[model samples]
Target: MDSKNRAKWACFGEIFEAVAQQGIDELDAVEALLAALRNGLRAYGYRRQFTFNESGKVERLPRDIYPQPVPVAIWRDSGTPKGDLTSIWQDDPEEPEVWISIDWVSGAVESLDWELTNFEHLRTDFSAIRIPRKEADHLLSDLAGRPKKRAGRPLGPSSPWEKEQVAAALRMIDGGDTRPATAIATGLTDTALIGKALESQQRRLTWGIKTALTGNAKNSANNKRD
Candidate 1:
């Protein structure tokens, strides 16, 4: 066997061994294998297709449609035709075609096939796959809302009010309140401040400072009662 085929079978063997170790039934085994294959294809930028028959006409349905008709066959494709260069079809002369025929009622994979030719195209460089412009923009927008890490020593509570705020936030957190709720109670709108309060609370517990503070509070209360 060629190196490519050998590698493919070896990977399949590993998946089979893992599924066998779980001691599942035949149906479960088939489902697990299907899931693994679908996930692997998605990771390589393959898009799914749902084929449906309506009134004697076959149609491709979008993923979000409700009451999804069981697909006669599942198809995944990736190539420059769709502005994606993440699949083997990027080098193929014809359009991409990879599909798995399914028996939905019996929950069995009927057949699996793909279009390929033996023309010596260079091996795919997955790391160098170019992202579509729209996807790249979306990723950038998502990252814009996240906090950026700063270099050098981390900053702590800079003022007495800030220290008190952190303490109040920590108390709310200890009461099992979520960060958003704690933020509202403590008037801490900045998520970074909420994070700092959690860190401070952890440090106090680690250093036994919480115990000391509790003891001091109890002694003050006793003195007042005296």
Candidate 2:
């Protein structure tokens, strides 16, 4: 959890303690107190996103819509100072405030640090405590007030296994060797090579499916065939 939310949860415990002595053992009172504490924490929340223009004033980006926090590696390349990100990001804030610092390892903006933050809440969620992946997702979904993010498009069917198979096939082709030799080099059995070849053929078919469905191959003979 971020420091602010951490403080809020801590304050909630304090509120519970103070009110427990008041003979308010009821759930409603406790819930109300917790809600009030959350509201107070929300009040202290600052705007992180912003819009900028040379001809006009900039408006603060809404916090509720902040992007999901992503873990980014900060590195300094050769001949450059450490923790300097001036080369990585845009030099001007004339664009929208799409990036914000959530937590820095060194507590300094220019320090070589890892920033852990949620960006675009539309695509992410936040929670009070860390949990296992399955439970964590369920908890976030329960707390989400807005529409949840989509699963997003798949890149392709090609994975590491397929990559190795393809590389082996290419090496065999380069050495003017036969398919059996390629299978041996790839550590795949003859049957496995046959399966992989079929899979590759299917992958090509799927790519064609995409082209036909999306009209992305408009100028190609592949499209003319349809």
Candidate 3:
């Protein structure tokens, strides 16, 4: 677990400790503790659907509202740096957060980095959303919250995976940010994350990004036909 998880779970102890120790004096600690306690009560809840039967009685529907999570082949490419995200999706916050991700080498979600939130629920429930990696890349890019490009110049990212933040940094430049300032803000010089801007590396990154975009588009077209 990461520091964020540890911090979140720590909220549970805030309330009991407040009274048992005769009240927590630290303001931030008190707030986090209280917030954690409140979250615990509401966080695990999920929506339940109801259906009206022929007899006019409201019947409780089965708990599995969605289809099981489908395991898919993880996209792999040397482009975009190591540990750079290949895929990401919105998680059901109500479910315990699992950073479930594809393990490309094994073609399995079961890996050291990620896990299914509820394997049983997935096995019995949740539908498949098989968007190709191409479309997925575009969708993921949008989800990352990039702004639309302006007319004068297209601000293509240095790395294929540099979606939202790159755009944000570009905006800073358009608003009169110096190279040094932009570099500092966006890690423009952060070669450590990706690598040196070599032409071959760029080609590979471009291909990966294109593959993701095309795959997502193909999935959408197929869905329409269905």
Candidate 4:
């Protein structure tokens, strides 16, 4: 090869190497964060908790279910340091971790993860309460129960982005924030679904979806109970 062509190929190899290294770095970072989250959960006596169906319905987690109360949090959002936290990354792998901004709370019997974010603390602040064992037992009873569902309607794994959009629509509805003028203002194409979501109180589209988005992140111990 000519000297000029040889040099061009060398530079191309270097650029390609850099890109590959960056992808490796991103994957390593994601894996490390997931490991740390699971480690903390183990330390706090928390288990896999629950798994969501394809449609996002909640189901028991079987053996990995927490034997006792354990403070936990999940990925909420990205781009802010508030209870409304956000993560900004585009490295989506085949089985990407949801990468929740979870923190180990200090003390409290049980509080809705969403409610905990509303404390006077900054969006970046972490707060947890210590709960007495006896009190925690009573408080944690019925913390997770099977959602009301129709027979023979099953959901399976779905694309994460698709789940997020569908869940977002449901959340907007559950909050009773259905305003028809919203479609007129935003010009979203799926106005019909949005309209039904606002007018209908469908649990399958509501709780089912949220469960699927934030379902059990750990699969090291796979145990499903029907």
Which candidate tops lDDT? 1
Instruction: lDDT for model 1, please.
Output: 0.36
TM-score of 4: 0.17
TM-score of 1: 0.22
| lDDT tens digits by residue: candidate 1, 178-217 | 6553233335433454577656534433233234346667
Q: What TM-score fits each model?
A: 0.22, 0.18, 0.16, 0.17
Better of 1 and 4 by TM-score: 1
- TM-score ranking from best candidate downward: 1, 2, 4, 3
Q: Which candidate is the best by TM-score?
A: 1
Segments in model 4 whose C-alpha atoms lie over 4 Å from true places: 1-42, 61-97, 103-226
lDDT (Cα, 0-100) at 171 in candidate 3: 64
- Tens-digit per-residue lDDT, 16-58, candidate 3: 2432354333333323322332333221112232333366525
For each candidate, what is the lDDT? 0.36, 0.34, 0.35, 0.34
Cα misplacement distance, residue 159 of candidate 2 (Å): 7.3
lDDT of 4 by residue, 147-196 (tens): 54458533421335434555565566568856542342233223455564
What is the total number of backbone clashes in candidate 3? 13
Q: Single out the weakest 10-residue window by summed lDDT for candidate 1.
A: 121-130
